[model samples]
Target: MTSTVYAPHDHHTCITAALANAKTLCESRGARLTPVRRRVLELVWQNHKPTGAYELLPQLAQDGFNSAPPTVYRALDFLLELGLIHRISSLNAFIGCAHPGQEHTTGFFICRLCGNALELSPERMQDVNTRLAEELGIVIEEQTIELSGLCPSCQLAATTAKEDIA
Candidate 1:
């Protein structure tokens, strides 16, 4: 079964692991993870929800960072280049990558009700991409699939509300 971000889990542990993995990957790649870049990454992993640059500006400002548009943009660009984060084009927001130090296409299942985003596993992603390539006869270059709908919890709530009213 695919893991859902909305499902209860130890998010603190997930965040810690992701950060550590990023640090290790950066060090091995000889990338300088500056203080601002590190903090921006931390904020991106603050929750399961994808965050927009504007949403992060105030937080950075409160933390005494420059919080300017260029600063945030540069950090975001660096993270994207390093594959540390994924941008949800549909929502204009960014989310921390669940898996780092690997090259794999990511598929996002975004919850419309709660705005939570979950990354599909690499295995599942590969299967889907393979199918698409075979069916379309096109070589895939870049992939970022974004699907939006109600999550399981939201579906249950909607059903319960309907039953109650009926």
Candidate 2:
């Protein structure tokens, strides 16, 4: 599915729903969505950009939260554990999951030009996985689908620049 991140929209709703989902997910798992964790999640969802742990430190400190690397790492790990967020291994950054709350196959698309990220739907990823497995007869033990390319907006910008120069 196309990401609204590259488009103009009411982003506040994204953060709001993410926070609420984190709360419910924590409650169901008998876990606490502590202030630090919540804040970390907030930071991740502040935009569609993939945020590095280091990038979050100053913000956390500015907000009066513990800015220690360990503290931030722990919060990130907790969010990852609960599937509230995902680690973009290629960029070593984190972004909030679009559809969290259960186990599902997913693919992440990162815009190489802008550094923004988006979570592709599980159904799409599942279809690929099922088709490959059924056709190849191989066990799917672990996988990470990270596609890097220019996003729609960036593609438009690049094309416009070329056209203007010509």
Q: Rate the local accuracy (lDDT) of all candidates.
A: 0.87, 0.90
**C-alpha TM-scores of all predictions:** 0.93, 0.95
Report the C-alpha displacement of residue 92, candidate 2, in angstroms: 0.8
Candidate 2 local lDDT, 1-166, one digit each (tens): 1358778888998999999999999999999999999999999998999999999999999999989999999999999999989888888899998887778887898899998888888899999999999999987987799998999899999999999999
Q: Which stretches of candidate 2 lie over 4 Å from their true place?
A: 1-3
**Cα deviation in Å at residue 86, candidate 2?**
0.5
lDDT of 1 by residue, 1-166 (tens): 1364788787887778778877898999999988889989999988888999988899999999999999999999999989899899988999998877678888989888888889888888999889999999989998769888998889999999999999
Model 2 reaches what TM-score against the true structure?
0.95
Q: Which residue ranges in model 1 land beyond 4 Å of their true spot?
A: 1-4
Q: Count the backbone clashes (under 3 Å) in each candidate.
A: 0, 0
